[model samples]
Structures are given as C-alpha cells and as structure tokens.
Target chain A: SQELEQSPQSLIVQEGKNLTINCTSSKTLYGLYWYKQKYGEGLIFLMMLQKGGEEKSHEKITAKLDEKKQQSSLHITASQPSHAGIYLCGADPYGQNFVFGPGTRLSVLP
Target chain B: DTAVSQTPKYLVTQMGNDKSIKCEQNLGHDTMYWYKQDSKKFLKIMFSYNNKELIINETVPNRFSPKSPDKAHLNLHINSLELGDSAVYFCASSLGPSNQPQHFGDGTRLSIL
Candidate 1:
C-alpha cells in the first residue's frame, strides 16, 4: 500500500512570519494538489502540481513539486491570521483516484 | 449560489439506524465524488460517478450505497450504520475524472451513538 506523510503534524506561526509544510509520498505522484480547510467548512483548492520541478503561487502561498515528483512543499510568506487553517496534500499515483494525507493544522498567532 | 452544497450539516443517529446525505453541484461538471474524512483528518474517496454513471467505487462496505440520478446530484445512503461510519462526509464535483480540480461542499458530520 502507498502512503503519504506530512511533516510537522501541526504548526504555529506568528503573524508576519514564514512557514513551510512538506508532503512526502511513497510512490511517484501523477498529480499533486494542495487544499486548505477552514474549521467547519469545505476544502478550498490552493494549487495543483503535475510536472516535476513545477511551482505555483497564489497570493502569499506557494507550492513546489520536487524533481523526483514524490515530494512537495507548501510555503507561506508573510503569513497572516487569515492564512491559518488545515493544509492537506492530495496525490494521485495512478492518475485516477486521489490519496490524501493527514492534514497539517496551521495556526497563525495574531 | 454555492457551487457545491450538502444537506444535514450534522447527523446523529443510533448504530442500527439508516441515514442518507444529499449532495448537489451546479458547476455542470461531469464527475462527482463522495469522500470520507476520518477523525484523524485523513480523507479518502469512497465513490465517484460521471454523467450519472458509476465510475469509481473504492473498497467501501456494502452497507453504503451511492445513487446518482443525474449529473448534478449524488446521494449517499448507509444501512445499519456502525460506529465506524461516524465521520465527515464531503461531496465534490470535477470537470472530469482526471487532471481536474474538485469543488467540495461543506461536509456532513455523522455521529453514531
């Protein structure tokens, strides 16, 4: 069975600080997606990475797929209170169904 | 209007009871899916339908049934629910099965007593 692991199961960052979260997969990723989930709400799509070494940024959040396509990282620069939420990485190993990782809870202190 | 919507934001029922959650999407997408989020925040896909036809069915138990009457609606029904059935169920839709971004609905939190 394939597995996806995320580092720093939880994080706390002061407002205006920077933070990074990593997601590693046991198999090569066909597609990698980043999503944010607010408390009591559905997940919001952040970005998608398909090719190796591909990177995307929306606002202050940036996501990068490693050259091996088995690991990805999400970086937040100048984090704010509004950026606090649960970050999840979903990977498709076979190009069909997605396998999601246990999310990393992020807290941005005001 | 919401792109994706689910009813019964919270559901609490006995272990032997049966329950249903309704989902709808207005994005005119061809694929819809049902996902379960466990207590540890691990999300897994249970079922998916494309154009009102069953496409992807995961290793879900037989007690759970998914009905897709149309391209825009997918409903989940669980029979004789057990304690393990308690979790957050999310409904999502995508333009197609592969390489498409999914839009999720606010999950229905199910609790079995």
Candidate 2:
C-alpha cells in the first residue's frame, strides 16, 4: 500500500482559475513536502510543513497541513500557465526514509 | 556550478553488462539518496547514505551497490545488469535526514537493450 496517496491523478484548468490538490497519508506526517517537476526535468522544492495546522505560501501557491497529519492540500490561486507541472507530495513520518506519492499532474492552459 | 550533478545524462547499454553512474553534490550536504523512476513514473528509493555511511538499503538485488566516497559524492555501480534496470536514476542530496529539502540532479536516463 502507498503511504501517501494523491487525488485526481490529472487535472486541467484555464488560466486564472483556482484549483486544489489533495494528499492523504496512512501514517502521521513528521514532515510533509511539496515538489513540482516539469517534463524531463528535476524536481523543484516548493514548500514543507512540519507542524499540524501549519500553512505556508509562496506567490500564488499556498499549502495547508491538517491537524490530523494524515492529509495535506496545495491550493493554487489564479493559476498561470507556468503553474502546470506534476505536483508531488512526500512525507517522512520519522524524519527519515521519505516516500513520494504518485503525483497529480496539473495543466493550466492559457 | 551545478548543485547536484550526474555524469552521462543518458545511458544505453545491453543486459548482463556492468556500468556505473557517478553523482556529486556541491551543496555539501551530509545525506544523499538514490531513487529509481520506472517507465510508469513510479519513483522508489533504493539507498541512502549519510556521511559515507549506508543508512538505508531497500530490497534491491545484490548486483546494485552504492558507494559514497565522502559526504559530497555518491556513486552507483551495477553488475550483471538485467533488463529490469532500465529506468531513470536520480541522485539527491539534503542537509540532513530531517525536513530539509532535497536537491536532485537532472537524472541519468538508462535504457537496457
């Protein structure tokens, strides 16, 4: 069984639309991270959450960690075309042996 | 300078051969990891090293070995390579085993013929 699971394997939205990607875990998330990967490119770190009910934002992207530590969500506000990529969620419950989810592919069209 | 670098961005070789992929991270991180992404894009961890010491080794076969010369370099050597070895290998480095973000090399695309 996958320790981390993401919803909506793929999604598409028009530019300036808001979208959310959800990640669920089977165990407590010691540290949860979000990364974005373009085709044929390496992953780029977006954000990380260590405390429950923690919320972090960068530009138009914001991520929230639930108090339960089993679910996390990434919210994109007024997305742009450049926001399109594979969104991956990784969690290391014990702060070791991090595992990544299958990823949610996002496509923001112009 | 490349933070995390891997040589031979692409590799194509036949089965039952021996090959090596070299990875070096200039970030001076203490922890390094090897991840394999299969054709289906499912990424899995194969091994992790902390300060030249093997910290995590998955259920990988014996033919696959990871060597860390120092805190900045980790190389992978594969022997008797099987067809199943065809995939993308990624080298990533982080500050430590905690919540630090990992910096990954572009990746080495290996194709087994």
Provide interface RMSD per model, one decimal: 0.9, 0.9
Expressed as tens digits, the lDDT of each residue in A3-110 for candidate 1 is 789998999999999999999999998889999999888999999999999999999999999999999999999999999989999886684577789999999999
Error of 1 at A95 (Å): 4.9
lDDT of 1 at B12: 96
Per-residue C-alpha lDDT of model 1 across residues B25-108, encoded as one tens digit per residue: 999999999999999888999999999999889999999999999999999999999999999999999998878788999999
Model 2 alpha-carbon drift over 4 Å, by segment: none
Model 1, stretches more than 4 Å misplaced?
A: none
lDDT of 2 by residue, B21-85 (tens): 99999997999999998887777889999889999898899999999988999999999989999
Q: Candidate 1 chain A, which ten residues in sequence have the lowest lDDT sum?
A: A91-100
Of candidate 2 chain A, the 10-residue stretch with the lowest lDDT total is A90-99
Q: How does model 1 do on interface RMSD, in angstroms?
A: 0.9
